[model samples]
Target: MNADLSRLANYLNPDKKKLAAKGITSVRSRVANLTELLPGITHEQVCQAVTEAFFAHYGERVDAEVISPDKTPDLPNFAETFARQSSWEWNFGQAPAFSHLLDERFTWGGVELHFDVEKGVITRAQAFTDSLNPAPLEALAERLQGCCTARINYRKRAKRC
Candidate 1:
């Protein structure tokens, strides 16, 4: 399926929230049915139809925000995060094996991240903050894990962070 259709399916499915709250096994049955149903209608025409239907049902709830460029959040300290790591051979193969250990401190937000990466994938991530509520930092760290550094669209993702 195309990226747009995949995104639409994810947006349409209420099971995403359920999957996050409940475990994968808890939603396995429904997911199987959904998987069976999705492919038949993933074509461009069906995607358009589904999009129209979705907007018809839920258009009132959709809010499009227009934030000014000057108000954008500062980009995370990726350079410092990547630089602190000590590289090593992860495995014996023709592919270059490397690992990175990253510890970054954000001066403005008082947020810190300790990330362990192997073969360009974050294997472990931990976040720390002086604030009593660390939810946002923790959430950010969780989202960073398994993210390919080269593939990340920093400008797009920074706004959410």
Candidate 2:
């Protein structure tokens, strides 16, 4: 189903070739599904909702270059995302205000994931042991799509279930 990410992703890039190459062809409706869950909402409404959420989450406190959902596979989960977005390095890495190095070490599911974000971008990264080091990141990327259910229409739930 099309949710917010897929809806906006399709709107931003209508041609299927790039999406196919990146193996993300089905995201369009995924975005649609998210907003449609809210009664009377169209796909466009979902995009606006997510964008508003994004801005609300990161406004005033930081200068975000682009709030685009991570299209890359293996998006990070909420904890990882909260950490990433809340970090001083990720938030001010690109700012002229200050420059500093960020270091963190954590283990999840028997694997250690090490990451550093500088200048609002990932600068250093490494994964130890398990291969799902990327899942957290992918989960984070898909956050926008997951956002759709936040305001789903109560009646629609009965109809679908």
Q: What is the C-alpha RMSD of each candidate to the true structure, in Å?
A: 19.7, 22.1
Query: By TM-score, how accurate is candidate 1?
Result: 0.33
Q: CA shift at 39, candidate 2, in angstroms? A: 1.6
Per-candidate local distance difference test: 0.56, 0.48
* lDDT for each residue of candidate 1 in 61-94, tens digit (9 for 90 to 100): 3544433433433459644444343232223112
Clashes of 1: 0
lDDT of 1: 0.56
**Pick by TM-score: which candidate is best?**
1
Each candidate's TM vs. the true structure? 0.33, 0.18
